[model samples]
Target: MPAPHSRSASTSVLASGSQVQPIQTPNVPLDRSLLLMSLAEEFFDAAHSIAPSVTLSRTGENVEVYEKLISTGLACLDTALSHVRLAPRVEANIRLRYAGVLYEETENFMEAEIALSKGIALCDRNHYYDLKYAMQLLLAQFMFKKSPKASLKALDSYISNAEAYQHISWVYALRFERAAHSLESSSLTDYHAALQNLRSIAKLAGEQNDRPIYMMASLMEAMAHLKSTGPESMEHAQRAIAAVWAYQLDSDNRIPQLLGLAHILDVACSLRQGNPTVMINKLKLMQTMMDEALRDPTWSTTSNVIAIPINRAQNSSQVVSPDTRTVLGIGNDGRDNLMLSFVSKKDAFSITYLLCGMVFLHRNSTSDQKGFKYLETGLNSLEADMRAPRASSGVLPDCIATLQWRGQIMCYLNCYMAFCAAAITDWATAKGHIEKVETTARDFDVPLVGPLGSVLVYLTGVYYQGIGDLDTALEIFQGKTFELPAETGKTNMMNSADQVERDIALLAALNSLWILQDGDRKNPSRNTTLIARLEPLCKSHPNKDIETAFNLVMATVETHPAAALFQVKNCLRAALNGAQTTANTQFLCITLSVMCNRFFSNVVGAQAEKSAQAASVQAQKSGNILWRSVADGMLAQCYEVNGKAADAKFTRDHAFKLAQMALPDI
Candidate 1:
C-alpha cells in the first residue's frame, strides 16, 4: 500500500445543514507550495507501490489484477508529472516511468522511445547521475533493434555512469546484458570475453543475493559452453543446470520459460555428447514444464501482445517539443514478463516436439513409424505459427525481433525434419519438407550463406540425392553463392566460417562420389577441387571419423580400387564400433555401396569370395536392410562372374525380395 497524503487542499466537506464550504490554503506562499508538494508526494508514493503490486499479482497468477495495477500506476505517474512544482529529478523519473509503462502495457514502442529519450535528455541536463544511469540501463532493451554497435555504446555509457554513481548492482546488470549480446558474435575473442563477463556477473549477483540474475547468467554461460565442441562442455552444462534447479527449488512459481531454456541447452549439450537417452528425458521434462506454465487451450484466439487502446498522448496529432514530457510509469514486474512472452508457448512446444522426434528417429530407427507423428505435429505447429500474423508481422521492434527469431527456428525445424525423414527413407515426405524449407527461406528472406543456411542447403541437396534427382542435387552442390535477406542479412554470429565450409566440403565430395559412380569422369576439375578440400580436412578436422569418411570417398574416386577397398573397411569399422548412430549413419550407406563395388571388382580371386561374404555379413549386422539388399545383389554378380549360375540366380531372387522390404511405407 502507498503512504497516504493529507488531501486537505483537494478535498471539501459538506455541513449537516447541506451548505458546503470550500477548503482554503493559508495566504503565505510557503504554505501554498507545501500543500502542492504534498499532492505530488502522494502521486510519487502511488507510483512506488505499482511495481510491487504488479509483481505480487503476476506471481499469484492474478493477471487481470496485474494488468489493472500497471494501468493505474501509469495513471498515477502521469498525474504526478503534470504538476508544475514537481522536482526535476522526480519529473525525469516520471517520464522514464511512462516510457516503460507504455512499452509494457500497450506495446506502444514509439511512445515509449519518445518518453525514454526525453527522460535521458532531462537527466543529462540536470546532472541526476543516479536517475540517468537507471534510465540508460533500461534503454538497452529498446536499443537491441536499432544496432548492436549502438546498443553496446549505450551500455558502456551506462556502466560508466553507474560506476560514477557508485551503483555496483546496476553495473552488474549492464554487464550481464553485454555478455548476452556478446555470445551472439562469431569472434573467438568476443566469445571468450562474454564467458568472462558472465562469470563476473554470476559472482557479483551471488554476492548481491540476486538469485534470478545469477540463474540467468548461469544459463547464458551454459549456452556459450554448449556452442563449444570442447571436452568440458558437458561439465559446464551440468553446472548450469544445477544452478537453475537450485533457484527453481527455492522460488515459488518461478518462470517456467527460464527453466525451459536451460533444459533446451541441456538437450543440445546431451546431443553433442551423443547421449540420446538423456536428451529425450530432458526434452520431455521441458515439454511438461512449458505446457503447464504457458499452454492455452484456445491458442488460436490469443494474441501474443496486449490489445490496449492508444492513450491520449499517442492519439495526439500535434508535433511536440523534445522537452515535452508525458506522464507514464510501468511496474518493473512486466519487463521479465515481456521478455519471456517474446518466446511464444507454441514455439517452445514445437521445438520440444521436434527434438523428441529427432532423438527417437536417430537412436531407434524402428520407432520412426511412431516418431513421424511427433515430427508432423511439430512441423504443423511451426507452419501455423509462421503463418500467424502476430508472429510474422508486428507493429513493434520486439515483435519484429520475435518474428525473426521464430523464422530462424522454423528453418531449422524444417531442415532437421527433412534430414530425419530422408534417414528413415521417407523420400516423398522428406522432399516435401525440403521444399518448404526452401520456400520459407525465400518467403522470409532468410540468409542462405550462414551456418543455418548451409545446413538447409546441405539437407536440400541430400534430399534431392535421396529422391534420385541427381542433376538437381549436383547443380545445388556446384553453386557456392548464397543469398541473405537484404535487411536482416547481418553477418550470422551463429554460423561460423569453419562450420559452413565443412558442410560445403562434405556435400561437394558426396556430389563428386555420385558423379564418379555414374561414370562421369570427364569433370576432373571438380574432383580436383574436392580432393584439395578433403585432404587437409582428413588430417586435421576435430571429428576425425567424419573426416575419414570424406577421405574414403576421395580415395575411392581418385586412388586404386584396392586402396578404396581398404578405406571402405576402415569406415565400416568406425561406423560399427566407434561412432554415434547420428554420425555413423551419414556415411554408413555410402561406405557399404562402395564396399559392394569393391567386392564385385575382385571376383576373379580368393579375395572375391571373402570380400563378397564380408559385405553381406557386415550389412546385415548394421541392421540396414537396404544395404543388405545391395550386398546380396553384388554377391550375385560375384557368383555369376565365378560361373556359379545356380547360386547367382538364388542370390538375385533374395536381393529383389530384400529391396522390396526395404522401401519405406510412405
Candidate 2:
C-alpha cells in the first residue's frame, strides 16, 4: 500500500545508509541546499503517509517495516531540520505537524488535542494555510466530543485553510461537525448556514471516488428541509432516501445512511398522517444491515474547525426523534471500554436524547412483547446519566433547560418504577417513590411555551396518574402547548426520529389523566368547563390512552363494579402487553396493579389479594423479596374478597406477618 522508500531522498557524505556526519554550520550550509531540501520534502511526505501503519501490527512481521519507514522519514526530516540555511520557524512548523501525527495515532486524545492545537496555531502564526489545513483535518474528530467551543475554533481555521486549498469535502465535513454541536436554542440560521456549506461542497462532488460525503450531506439537507418546509419536506425526504439507496449508500456510509433514513421514516410515522408505519419497518431492516456493515471496520472521522456561528440549515427535514441512535449494534462502547476513547462529547450528548426517544417510541410503537427489554434498557441507560455530565461537572447556563428536562424524565422514570412496584403490589416502596415524583413535579414549572411544556404536562399528569387521579392527568395531557411536533431537544443537532416518542409520551400522559379522573361527574371533577376543554381532543383522537384510563377511573367509581372490573382488566392487558414489549415493564405493571387496586377502592383484602398474585408472578421470575410480600399481602386480601369476615381479619394478620417475613426491617 505504500510508495517505495527511495535511497535518493537523502544524500550521504560517505554512503553508509545516508547516516549524517555532524554538520558544522559555518562552512557551506546553503551550497547544495535546494537539491537536499527537495529530497527531504519527498521523504517527509512519504513518512506522513506511512505513519498510520504503526497501529497495524505488534508482531515481528510488520514491525521492522514500520520502524524502517519511520526511521527513513525521520532521518530525512532530521537532516532537513538541521539545514543551517532554513528559518527556525519553518523547521519548527514541520516538526510540530509530525508530533501531531504521533500523538493522534497513539490515542492520547489530551496530548493529541494539545499538540494539534499548538501545531495548527504555529501554521496560522506563520501563515502556512496549506499545512494548517492538513493538520486541521487531523484534529477534526476531536472537536465535537471533547470541546465543541475549541472544536469550532479549529474547524473555522480548517475551513479557512480548506478554502485556500479548494478542498470542498473539508468544508462539508466541517458543516456536519458544526451541526453535531448545535444546541436547542441555536437558531435556524445555524442550520441554514451548515446546509449552505454542505450544498456548496456538493457542487464539487464527483462519482469517481464513491462520494460518501456527498451522500451524507444530501441526506442531512433533505432532513433539514422537513423542519423548514411544509409541502416540500416530504419530497426532500423521499429524494434524500432515494439518493442514498440508489447510490448504494448502504455499503459505503451505511451508518449515516440508515440513521438518516430511519430519522425521516420515524418522523413520518410520528406525524401519523400517512403510511409511515411501513416505511418505519423498512427503515428498521436497513438499520439492521447498516449495523452489520459497521461490524468489522472502524473508520476515521476527524472534525473540522469553524469559527463562525453555525448557520441554521433548512429544517425542512422531518424532525427525527432522538431514539434512532440508541439501538444496540450501533457499536456504542462496551461497559468495560475506556471512556477516553470517545470521539466527541457532542456525540455522547446526542445519544442521551436518542435513548429517551427510544423508550418513548418503544412504549407506543407496538403491542409486541418482544420490545420491552429494548425500551427498558434505553430508559435505564438514560436514567444512568443522572450522574453529572462527563464533559464538565459545572453546568453551563445554556444547559439549564437540559437539566430541567432531565429532571422531568426522572419524574417519568420514578413514576414508571413506582408503577412497577404497585403492579406486583409492592406498595411501600411504590408509594414512597410516587410521592417523590410528585414532589419533583411540584418544584418543576411546566412552562407555557418551549420544550418543557409538553414534558411538564406529561410529568405532572403522570404523577397524578400514578396517584390514581387519571381525570386530572387527562386534562393536562390535552394541553397542546406541550405537544412538540418533534424532538425539540434536537433543535439543531441531528433531528433523528423523535416524533414517534413524543406521540407515545402523549399517550402515557393522557392515560394518566383519564384513568384517574373519577366517575363522579355530577360534580364532573365538578368542573364542567374543564371537561369541555378536553372534548375536542377526545373527539379527534377518540381519547385512546384516556379511553382505557377513563374505564379505569370508572372502575374505581362507586356505581359500576362490573364495568370497573372490565376497565381495569382492559387497561392491564393492553398496557401491560405494551409495556412488556417496550421493556417498559414497570409502566405495564404499575398501570395494571394500580388500576386493579383502584377498582377495589383500596379495600384491605382486595389490594393485598391482587398484589399477591402479581408478586407471586414476579417472584417466580426474579426471586425478589419485595415481590413475594406483595403476593402474600394480596393473598390475604383474597380471603376478604371471599366475603368471610373472620377469614378477612385472619388474612390481615397473615398479611402483616408476610410483610415482616418479606421485609425484616419493616
Candidate 3:
C-alpha cells in the first residue's frame, strides 16, 4: 500500500468578532451620544461573552445568539459614529471592534474589510499609530486564506508601519505572519528563509521574556522540520516533541487550541519515528486530552486564533453536501451503524483516528477490521463537520477552506478503504471506494498530482488485477493507460514526492513483470530484459519491502533447479526480514507460497507440506481471500503427496469454497 504523506496548507487566521458596518455622517440629538455608545459596548460585551460557544457550536443556535448581539452592537456603534463628537481614536477603536465582530461572528468579510479600512484612516488622521498597525495586522490575517499574495503584501506594509512606530511586538507579529506565508510557497529558498525568520523570532522573543511568542515560534520551527525529509528528519521530529513537551509543562498559561495542536504535532512526530505501538498509545492519550478539554467550559471562551496546518485540495469550486448516505452507504441503516458509532467531535483530535487507522494498515496485522473502524469514524466526523451550517457555499473563504481540508482527508480515507476491501477480495466494495475517491477529487477539484495520483493509479491496477483483467492491470501498472503526467526532470533524491513516485512506479513494474512472466512462459528473453531494467531502479529506490518483492521475482526466473531452490530460500529470508522490519504480511505470504511450490516441484513432500502450512497460517492472518485460497490449495496438494487422503479431500473442498468466495465467476 502507498503511504500517505502529510502536507501543510496555507495559514489561515480565524476571525475575531470585533468588526462592524461603515458609519455614515448624519444628524442626531446631542443627548443620544453617550447612551448609544453605552448600548454598543453592552452588545459587544454580550457577543464577546458567547463567541467561544459560536466557535464550537454544532448547531446554529449559538451562532444565532452571537450574530444577534454583534448585529445590535454594530447598529448602536454606527448611530454613535454618525453624529457624536467622539475623539478620533475612540471612534477608530469602535470601528475596529465592529469590524472584528462582522468578520468573525457574522462572516461578513466585505463589511468587515470596509470598516477596518475606515478605522485605519481614522487612526492615521489622529496619529493613533498602535491602533492603525493593529487593524492592519487584522486585515492581513483576514486575507490569508482568501488571497495569500495579498495577505503577504499587507503583512509587508504593516511590518514597515510597526517598525516606523518602534512597536517591537507588532513588528514581530507582522514578521511571523510573513514567514508563515513564505512557508506556503513550494520553494526551497522560501522554506529556508521562513525557518530563519522563525529562529530569529524565537531568539528575540526569549531574550525579551515573551514566552508565548517564543513558544509559538518554536512550534512553527518544529513544524517546518517535520515537513522536511532527510537524515536530519528524525532529529527534527525529536526536537518537535521536546518543544511540545515544554509547551505542555506551562500549567499557569494553557491555551486549549494551541495545546491541542501541539499534542497533534507530538503524535505526528511519534508516527514519523516508525514506532506503531508508541504512536497508537500517544494517539489514545491525545484523545483523552481532547475529551477533557471539551468538557471544560473555559476551553470555549478563549479568543485566541487557531490556524490549522492541514493541506487543502486545490481548486474547490463549490461546497460538497454533507449528506454522504448516497455516496458512502452510511446512514440510519443498521448495517453501518456500528461503524458510525465511532464517530466523535469533528476537531483537531479527530485526525488522530485517521492516523491510527493508517498505522494499523501499515503494520502486519491478521485482520484489517480495526483499521477499517478507525477510518470509518474519521470519515464520518469529517462529513459531520462538512454538514455544519457554516460550511455553505456563500461563506467563501471558510467554505472553500473547509472543503479543501476535509476533501483531502476524505480522499485518503477512501483510498485506504479500497485497499482494505481489495485485501479481502471484496471487489464490489473496493471498486465503490475507488470510485468515491475519484469523484471526491473531481468534486473538490483536487489536482491528481504527485503521490496522490500515484496511489490512485496503483489502486486502479489492483482493482483490475483482482477482477482477472490482467491485460488492463498490466497497462495501468506500466503507466501506459493512466492520464496522469509522467515523472519529469531530475528527481530530488531526498524529496518524499519523488520517493513515492518511484515506489509506485516500481510496484507497478513488479506487477507488470509478474503478469508477463506468467503469461509468456516461452519468451524467456523478455523476462530477462525487464529484470535488467528493474534491477538498477530497485537499487536506486532502496525500499525494504520493494527490495524483498524484487528478490522474490528474481527467484522465479532461475532456470537451474538447485539455483532456483537456493534463490527461493534466500528470498524467503529477505521476506521474513521485511516482515519483521516493515510488517508487510502480503510479502511474507507470497514468498512462503513460492517456496512451497518450489519444494513440491522438486518432489520434497515433507518440506512442501511444511512451507504450505506456514503460508496458509500467514494468509489467514492477512485476511486476504486470494492468498488464503492459494495457500490452502497448495496445502491440500501437499496432503495428497503425504498419502493423507481424507485430509486432502477436506482441505481441497475448503480451498475450493474460498476460491469461489474470492472469485464467484471462477
Candidate 4:
C-alpha cells in the first residue's frame, strides 16, 4: 500500500503523507485495525492543500466534509489513551496530541499540561527540534494567560533545547518566542532594554512575508516602545510610524494613532532642540492625524475615545451651535459664557487636551494678540465640549467605554494656570483657578491620577501656605497620600514608581494640617508623628521626591524659624543635583522665600551659612532669580540679625548683585 499524506496529528489521530479513507471503529474486532489506522491518518498531510471530502458507509448518513474531517482527527484520541503504554512512537504522539486538545476544552488543565508536556519532552529529549517548537508553541499559548510566571520559566528551560536540536534549523522559529510575556515578567526588568529587544523582533519580522504576524509584531513592538520613553526613544517611535506607512490602510488601524503619537514625540523633541520648523510640522501632523482618527467608524464611539478623552472631539463640529445661542436667549457672543446652555459637544479627551495645550500656549503667546484670542476661544470650546452628554439613549457603541477617568489631565491644566498665577503673585486669579481645580479633582478615583495628582496634592498645600494659613497648610503638607503604582506590569523596571498607598498617605498627611483646627496646626501643637514619618524618608532617600515631601512638612508645620529655613535650603540644594522638572524644586524655593520673611524665621546665623552654600551650586539653575535671591537675602538678614555689622553690609551688597544676575525681571 502507498504511504498516506498528512502533517498535523494528535495523540490518537494519525496524519499521513497522502489522502486515504477513514476506517470505522469496529464492535467486532476481527479486522486488522492497523490497516484502518494507516488510512485514517493520511488526511492531515495535505489538510491545507486538498479540500475535504465526506463519504457515507451503509450504516451512516452523509455528513459535511469539514465536520467529517474534524471528527476523523478527533476520533484518533477517543480510544488511544487507554493503550498508550503499548502504542508505537508515532501512535502515542498522535494520541497525545488529540488528547491534549480534548483535555483543554474540558478545562482539565493538569491533564492537558501533562499530555502536551509528555509529547514535547519525547520530541525534545530525542532532538526533534521542529516537533518541539510546535509543541512549545501550543503549550506557551495556554500558559501565557494563566501562569505567566511558570510559562516564562518553562520557556527558558526549552531555549537550550532549541539550540542543541539538529532538526530545528536556524530557519525554524525560536521555541522561546514570548518576548512580550518576558517583558511582562518581573524577571525582565528595564523598559529601555525591553524596548530594544522588541524593536529587534519587529526588524526581523519585516524581512518575512508573514503579513499577520509581522504587522502584529510591529504594532506590539511600537506600543511597548512608546510605553517606556528611553534612549533615542524617537527612533523607536519613528519606526512604529514607518510601520504604519508601510501598509496602505483605509480604516483606523491603531497604527496611525501610534504614528500620530510619534508626531507628538517629534514635536516635543524638536521644541527642545530649538527647531521651531520641525516642531510646527510635527504638531500639525499630530493634529491632522488625530482629526482623521476622530472620523474613524470603528473607533468613533466613546469607548474607544475614552482611553484618549482629549482626542474624541478632534473631528467634532462647532462647539457652539447657532441654535444653541438662539435658545439661550442671549445676544451674539455678549457677556454670556459660550457653554452656558449648550448641549453635549465633545468627549472628555477633547476637553483635557485643549485645556493642557492652552496652558503652555498662554505662557508663550500673551504677546501675540491673535494667539491670545485663539487661546481663549479654545478654552470656551473645551468648556462647551465638557457639557456634552456622556451617552446617548443608554445604548452606547460597543467601542465606547461606560466609565472614564481623566482627572489628572484636567487637574494639571487647571493647576498649571493656577500655579503660574500664584508664582507671579496674582493671588486673586490663582485663588479662583485653584478653586476650579479642586472641583475637577473630585471627579476621579484620586490615587489613579498618577504623578499629576501627586503634584496637585502637593501644590494645594503650598497655595494654602501662600495665603498665610500656615496651620491649615501644614496639615495639607503632612496629609497621607498613596503613591500611584506603575501602570505597566510589575516586571517593568522604572525608577521612582509610586504606589497608591504612598500617595494616599502623603495626601492624607497634607490634608491633616489644613483640616485640623487651629490649635492642632500650630508648631508646638503639631503631632509628633509628622516629624517621625518625614525624618525617615529624608534619611533613607535623600534625593528622592520623598525627601521633598519631608521638607514640605517642615516648611509648613515647624514653628522653629531657624529649622524651617534649614529644611528649605536642604531641599533647594538637593534640587540642584536632581535633573527633573518636578514641582518639588519650585515649591521648595517659593516656600523658602515665604518662610524666610516670617517673624519666627529670625535665625540669622544659620540662615547666612545655608544661603551662602546655595548660591555656589550651579546645578539649581532654574533660569530664575527667586532661589538664589531668597538664599542671598536670608544670608544678609542672618548677618544683620546677629549684629555682624561688616558681614551684614557685605552680604546685602552680594545679595543685590546675585539677584540682578539671577533674574533680569526681578
Candidate 5:
C-alpha cells in the first residue's frame, strides 16, 4: 500500500511532452488566515485570564461577557477554516485550541471531547507523533473527573508509548501523572509508592536540568513529607525548604505561586513540629507574602488560581441527593462538579485566617475571641464562594473547588466553632455545629475511618463530657482504640491522617481515664487498671497534652495523703508550665480546679481559697461554665472549713446554679 497521506505531500499529473502540472487545492490567503488564528489565540488567552475573576464574581453580566469572548474566538477559527483547505498539522492545532476553550471557558465538555477526538484523528493520519501524544494527555485529563479508572488506563498506555518513542520529557510527565493518581488513592501503600516515585522524578529532572519539573517534584515531595511523622520527616521538610529557598534566590527562576506554596509548607512544618512561637511567626510572614502576591497585577492575573490535583474515590451505588448537592455546591447534572482541584487567592487568604484562628484559640483565654472572629471570617468567605451561582455545575468553579479539600476545611471550621461555643457554655450552638459536621460527613460520604471522621468522634465525646453525662462520655471515649504498628526494626513513619487518628484516640483515652478516676474515687484499682493501659500508649504517642493529663490522673489516684498532695503539687507545676508554654487557658483552669479540690479536702483554707479564686478567674476568661462551677464549689467548701457559714451557703448556691445552667437535666 502507498504511504498514508501526509499534509506536506504534493500531487502532480504528467502532461504531454514530458511536462508535469501540479494539482492545487482551494485555500485561504495565508496572511489573512494567520492573522485570524493569531487573533483567535489572543481572545482565548484573554478569556482564560479572566476566568478566575468571573468565577469569583459569578455575576450574570460577567458570565455573559466571558461567554461572548469565547464565542468570538470560536467564530474566528470557523471563519479562518471556511471553505479552505489547511495543512493537517495546522488544522489539528486550531481544532485542539478550540477544544480547550470549549472544555475550559464554555464548559461544553461533550463538544470539547468531539473536537479533541477529531484533532487526534487528524494527528494519527498525518503521523504527527508529538501532537498526537499531547492530545491524548488532554483527553485523559478530560476523562479523569468522569471516569478515573478509564483515565488512568489511558495514562498508563501513554506512558508506555512515551517510553517506546524515547521521549524523555513526555515519559517524566506521564509518570508524574501516574504518581499523582497514586497519591490520591486511599491506601497508605499507594501513598508511599507515590512519594518514592516523586522523589525519583525530582532527582532525574534535576539531573536533566529541567528546572520547572524539578521544582514541581521537589515541592510535592516536601508536601508529602510534611504530612509524615518522626525526625526524618522534619529533616525532609527542612531539605525541601532549603531547596525552595535556593530556587527563590535565583531571581530568573522565581515563581510567585510556587514561592507562596513553599511559604505555606514552611508554616505547616512549624505546626507539625508543635512550636507555637515559630508557627505564629511563620504565619505572619505568610500573610505578608499573600498580600504581596495579591498586589502584583501580573501575579493576580496569571497565578491567582493554582490547581492542586486530587481524585476522590466515589461509590457508584450511592447517588447524591438534591439537598446534598446544594449543600456541597454540586451541579444539578449529578456529576461530581466540585471535584475540580483549584485554590484561589481568596482561598489562600481564608486558609491563613483559619490557621490564625486555630493558633489563637489554643494560645490562651486572652485571644479566644480574636480566634473565634477569625474563624467566622474564614467560614463566611467559604460559604459565600459556595453560594455563588455558576453557569454549569460541570464547569470548574474559580474558588477552592476541590470537593475533598473544601469538605475537610468546612468540617474543621465547624469542629472548631463547636469547641469555641462549648467553651463559652453555648451548648445549643455547639450542638448545632456538631450536627452540621455530621451532615457534611454524610453528604460528602466521608469515611468514619478517615481523619475528619476521627475528629468528629472525639468531639462528640467532648460534647457529652461538657453536658455532665459522664457515663455516656466515658463509653464514647473508651469505644475507640488506637494501636501502634509492630516495630519491624525500621522507623515507621505515620502520615498526618494516621497521626490525627491516633492523637484523637489518645485524647479519648485520656478523657476515659479522667472519668474513671472521678467516678470511682473509692476504687483506686479501677483507676490503676486504666492508667496501666494508658501509660504504654502515651509513652509511644508522646503528646504533651496526653502526658499532662496522665500525670494529673495518676496524682488523683494516690492513696497516701502526703504523697497525694506532693504529686498534686508537681502535677500543678507541670500543668502551669504547659499553660504558659502553649497559652492554653482551658487546661490551666482544669488543673487549678483539681488543685483547689485537693486543698479544700485537706482543710488548707488559705491555699484552697487562693487556688479557687485563680481557677474561677481563668474559667471566666475561657468562658467555661463547667470549670467555673467546680471552682466555686471548692471555694464554698473552703469557706465552710474557715467557719464562714453565710459565705459557704451563698457560694454553694451560686455553684449549684451554674451547674444547673451548664447541665439542665442535672
Candidate 6:
C-alpha cells in the first residue's frame, strides 16, 4: 500500500528535518471506512485552510476556497459512494459530511437534500439516534425556504421524538423561526399560531426572569399584534421598552440594538396613534442608536446593500439577527452577520435616513426638500450596492433579491415625491414620479394599488386636478379599489391600509369640492354621499391639518360661504404662524381662491378680504405658476369688489396669462 496523494500543502520541511519523523506507508490496503473518513478530513482541512470557519468569509480569497472545497468534496463523495461499501456508521457520517459540504459551498439544494435524506435514513434504520435530531433540524430549517408548512411538520416530529436532546434555546429558536415564517401568509390560523408561539416564549421567559428573551419575544409579539391591528400592540411595545430599561446597565454601547428596536417600535406605535410629535422624537433616538452602531469599528464591512438589522420592523427582521440566540449580540453581530452577506451597513443607513426624512417631510413641510435629498442619497447608495458583483442572496438569486428591495424603496420614495410635487402644484413632476412608480409596480409584480395603492391613485388624481383636468381627476378619484393581496412586500406609510383609507377620504372630498366648483349644483345627492364619506374619515383621524381641509370642503358643500371664509382665514393664519401649518402652496392657492369667491358673493368681512390678500402675496412668492395664477385671480376679484374696474380688467388679463402658462400641454 502507498500513502494517499495530497494536492494541498506540502508535508516536506527541510529546516525542521530532525524534529519531523518520516511518514510510513502501510503494507495492507486501506479499508473503505478508513478511506471515507480520510476523505472527509481532507475536505474539511482544505476548506479550513482558506477560511477560519465554514460560515464566515471576510475576504474574496475565502470565496475561492469555498469553490475549491465544493469541487473536491463532490468528487470525493461521488467516488466513495460509487466504488466503496462501508459500515452503517461510516456511511452515515460520510453522507452527513457530503450534505454539509454541498449546503455550505454551493446553491445545489437538490444534491444536498439527497445526501441529507440518505444520511437521515441511515441514522433511523440503524438506530444511530444521536445524529437523527440534528439531521432533521437541518432538513426542516432548509424546508422553511421552500415550504413553511412542511418545515413546521418536520419540526413537530423532531420535537416529539427527541425532546430531551434539544437545548432550551434551540426549542425557543425553532418556535420563533416558525412564527416568523407564518407571518408571510395572511391566514388567521397562521397569525394565531405565531401569536401563540410568542406568548409561550414570553410566558416562559417571564417565569425564568430571562429579561433578554422576554424583550425580544415581547417586541416580536408587538409586531405580530401590529400585523393583525390588535388593540394591545402599543401596550406590548411599551412593555418591551420597559423590559429593556429594567435590565439595561450602562456600559460600552449600552445594549444599543435593543434600545434601537425599542425606539423604532415606539415610533411605529406613535404613528398609529397619530402622534407625529412623539414619532419624531422616537425617530431621532433611533437615528442616534444606529449612528453609534455604525461608528463601532468592530462591525464587518459588507458588499451588499446591507439592510439595517432594523427593517420597517416587519416584512423581514431576519436581517436584525441571524438566529434567536444571536439577538443578544445585536451591536456585536453587525460585522459577523454582514460576513454572512445577506445584509449590509448601507441597508441600515438607508432605512434610518428614510425615517428621519419622513419626519422632516411630514412635521415640517418647509424642510421637505431636505427630506427628498436624504431619500435620494439613500436610494442611490442602495442601487449601487445592489448592482455590486459581490452581493449575495441567501436563498434566491442576488439580482432578484436586489430588485425586490429596489422596488420596495422606489415605491415609497416616488410616492413621497408625488406628494411634495402636488403640494407645490408641480403637476408634471408629480405625474412623472407616479408613472415611474406604476411601471415599477408592474415590472416587479407588486400591486400598484394595495395598502398604499389608494394613496398613489389619489396623488395621480390630484396631479390631474392641479392641471384643471377636473373630469379626469374625478374619474380616477371615484375608481373602484381592489382588495389587497395577503402579502405585500413591506409595511410602511407608503404601503399601509390605514394610509390608503385616509387618502381615499381626502380624494373623495376633493372630488366633491371640484364638482361643486364646476357648477354641478344640480347633483347635490352625489355630493352629499361624498361629503358623508369624508366626514367620518376626517373625524376619526386626529390630524389637525387634514381636518382643516375637510372643514373647508364641508362648508363649501353646505353652501355656507361665511363658514368657508372662516376656515380659509384660519388656514392663512396657520400658514403665517408656521405652527401646525398647512403651508403647502397649492392648498394655499385653493384657500385664497375660495376667499375670492366669498368676497365676490358678499359673504366675507373686511378681515377675511385682508387675509385673502395676504395669502395671495404668499402664493405669488411660492414660485408655482398654477398657484400664482390662482393668487392673481383672487387679487383681480378683490379689485372688482373695490369698484376699480380698470385695475380689475388689467389684473384679470394677467391672471388669465398665468393660468394659460400653468396649464399642461395636451
The prediction achieving the highest TM-score against the true structure is 3
**How far is 289's C-alpha from truth in model 2 (Å)?**
1.3
Residues 454-492, model 4: lDDT tens digits = 666666666665555666666566545433222423422
Q: Looking at model 6, which ten-residue stretch has the lowest summed lDDT?
A: 1-10
Report the CA-based lDDT of candidate 2 relative to the real structure: 0.44
Instruction: Judge candidate 1 against the unseen true structure and give its global Cα lDDT, from 0 to 1.
Output: 0.58
Q: Listing every candidate in turn, what is its Cα RMSD in Å to the true structure after a full C-alpha superposition?
A: 11.8, 15.2, 12.5, 19.9, 13.1, 9.5
User: What is the TM-score (0 to 1) of candidate 2?
Assistant: 0.42
lDDT of 2 by residue, 1-666 (tens): 322332232233215334433443666553344445444445444434443332222234434544454456445555664654555355545455444444433345765566557666776778654345445655766555566667666676767755565443335444555554442214556656666655655554543232554555566666566554234456666666565566654453344423434454444433332233443455455445444434433322221111111122232011111111111011222111101112222222223333333433434323232223343453465456544233231112213334455456655555555544444344565666656655665554323233333443455555554454556666776565445343223422333333323444546534533453445433444333433343343322322343343333333333322334564466466555544433433344345455445545335555555554664454434323343455445555666566766866765675566566555543
For residues 1-666, could you state the per-residue lDDT of candidate 6 as single tens digits?
Answer: 001112332132112332423343466554655654565555555544443222222344545544554466567676777678877877766676666556555667777788779888888898665355446656775677678889878776665543355334444545666677676667667777887877776676666454555666776776766554444555665665565666556453243445556666666666555555676678777777778778864344444422122111221232223322222113344321111123345665766666666665664353236666766677677667645554232312243454566677767777776766665566788888889788877765566645567767777777877787778777776666522223432323221355556456565556646555675543566666655555665643444556656655654555322235575566444433322353344455555556555554443356645755765675664556676777777777766776768877997898888788778463
Candidate 5 C-alpha error for residue 425, in Å: 2.6
lDDT of 3 at 382: 75
Instruction: Using lDDT as the measure, name the better of candidate 1 and candidate 6.
Output: 1
lDDT of 1 by residue, 508-591 (tens): 655646565565554555656646555654543444445545555554655432344566566555543433444344345546
Deviation from native of the Cα of residue 586 in model 2, angstroms: 16
lDDT of 5 by residue, 1-666 (tens): 011111011111112112311232355333556656866765555554555555555567666655655677788787765644777867877776676656565556687788778888898898766566656766777887677778778887988876666555555656677677766665567667677777766776666565545666777788777666665787787797777677666664455666777788887777666566887798888888888878755344313333221111143112222221211123333332212133556667677777777767666444347777878888888788667643322332433245446666777888888877777777788888889888866654445567777777778888888877888887788774434334322334566777778778777876766666574434566656656666666643434656666666666664322344565688677766666656567777887777767655647557767767787778777677777788888778888888889998998999888888888877
Model 5 reaches what TM-score against the true structure?
A: 0.67
Instruction: State the local distance difference test value for candidate 4.
Output: 0.44
Question: Which segments of candidate 4 are over 4 A away from where they belong?
Answer: 1-197, 209-256, 268-386, 389-403, 432-435, 444-449, 470-475, 478-666
What is the RMSD, in Å, between candidate 3 and the native fold over all Cα?
Answer: 12.5
Taking all chains together, the TM-score of candidate 3 against the true structure is 0.71
